[model samples]
Target: MMSLAYFNGNIIGIDDPVIPIDERGHQFGDGVYEVIRFYQGKPFMLKEHLDRLFMSAKAIKLEIGKEQEELEALMLELAGKSGLADADLYVQVTRGVAPRNHLFPKCPASLSITVKPARELSHQVRSEGVHIVLLPDERWQNCYIKSLNLLPNVLAKQEAFEQGCFESVLVRDGMITEGSSTNVFIVKEGKVQTRPLSRYILAGITRLAVKEITGEQGIPFIERAFRPEELLEADEVFLTSTTSEVLAVTAADGRQIGDGQPGPVTRRLYECFQQKIKAM
Candidate 1:
């Protein structure tokens, strides 16, 4: 039941003030991050998560100063040290500490990591399902990159919370993009449809898991864009992320979805996802 943190090469308290004010990640949001979940002390899809982390760092033109295997080993070592069987491991790579400037600094990159207990959704919420709010997607065009620039997402999530909703479904150009922190999916006629991978939406690992489950289960999985109206009209809707895996959305903007309950298709997918975890 302990939370651990690692800054640079030293393990420290989770709330340690080791980062300097001139750090680019603190000053300019110049960094990329990843959150990997451990189930029963085993990391799920760790290679895929690391691949995306490197991709995000390259997209930001920030050298991580460590090989992929090296970073992976470090993360595993830190998680083991935390002694938590189920945990959320957050890894952040920044452009390093330097004088205040808009230009890149000639310094080594900074690495920060934290391992905390997993934040599992309550059984009541998962069984009963959750509600969401539709909002305009105001983020930059590079939503594919897992960068530290999350002010727009934070604002949208806060707005949803104020409206007594669990999440915010964002729309861009009249088509539903994604949630502030999850991938959106709609089920119609027993087929699952989600927005395709693009610069406008992130390629979520949990979303990929759902795709694999649908394939193995012989369920139709479509990667195509749909409008808000389509989502409203969908027989069922759900969201996926590292934390909220295969969560059902029972209502949107106070409107009931699919008899206002978690649908059969969603439950099937979620059960398959849990089996995937068990086999991991």
Candidate 2:
């Protein structure tokens, strides 16, 4: 089925949605974006996603053209019109269109909203877990902002794919920062540890939810910078994202991660995450 998108102020076919060629987002990547998931026709953690979106825009000095409540209502309306009970809702706000220049455009900003079916991980990958590869972190310092500039992430992900891996676990200096497009976590002696929110990584909404879920389940959770050596010694490793949700990492750079299987702790959290979605 044809997908739908809300461009500027009009809801139209995804392929036909229009944006000015001089839009700052297109020219300078001066925009912030958020990806939210929907289940049973309702957006999951809608408020949290919106909060992050606003934060990202503020960090980059980009203005949201509309009110938060209005944007939320519009997203839900578009999601409903897309006819997908479970979907990925994407929202992007750019500095708008103006004459070609490096300066912020004087025109009002443009907003784009698109709702597409959520693609869950393959059953085999979910059951057997994924294989990851480590790569040097080549991104800019301000990784906290969810900006449209994704060339570094694209390169890392492409390298992983070329090497027959599902994702790239990024390493900076000697510590694990995050994945190319997701947050990284590890299990050690029954405790869950992930990188603390910093300029080195994006503060993932799913990562935060995972922390809360683990806490509610009485699982130990820690936020700290983990060395690459620590990942090798970890009982289990996984990734979290708006679309990927929770995915176990069974291998890294062809090295088996804890018997080369999805560890019990990961399975437990995966089950809990599924339940949370159903409840949502």
The candidate that wins on TM-score is 1
Output the worst ten-in-a-row residue range by lDDT, candidate 1.
Answer: 12-21
lDDT of 2 by residue, 1-280 (tens): 3368988889988888387788788898889999999888888899989998999899988789788999999998899889998888899999888988987767888899888888877899888999999999999999998999999999999999999999999989889999999999999988999999999999898898899899899999999999988898789999999888999999898888998889988889889998998887
Give the winner by lDDT: 1
- RMSD (CA, Å), candidate 1 to true, equals 0.6
Candidate 2 segments whose C-alpha is farther than 4 A from its true place: none
Candidate 1, lDDT over the whole model: 0.96
Model 2 steric clash pairs: none
Q: Cα deviation of 60 in candidate 1 (Å)? A: 1.0
Cα lDDT for residue 29, candidate 2: 88
Give the CA lDDT, 0 to 100, for residue 53 in model 2: 91
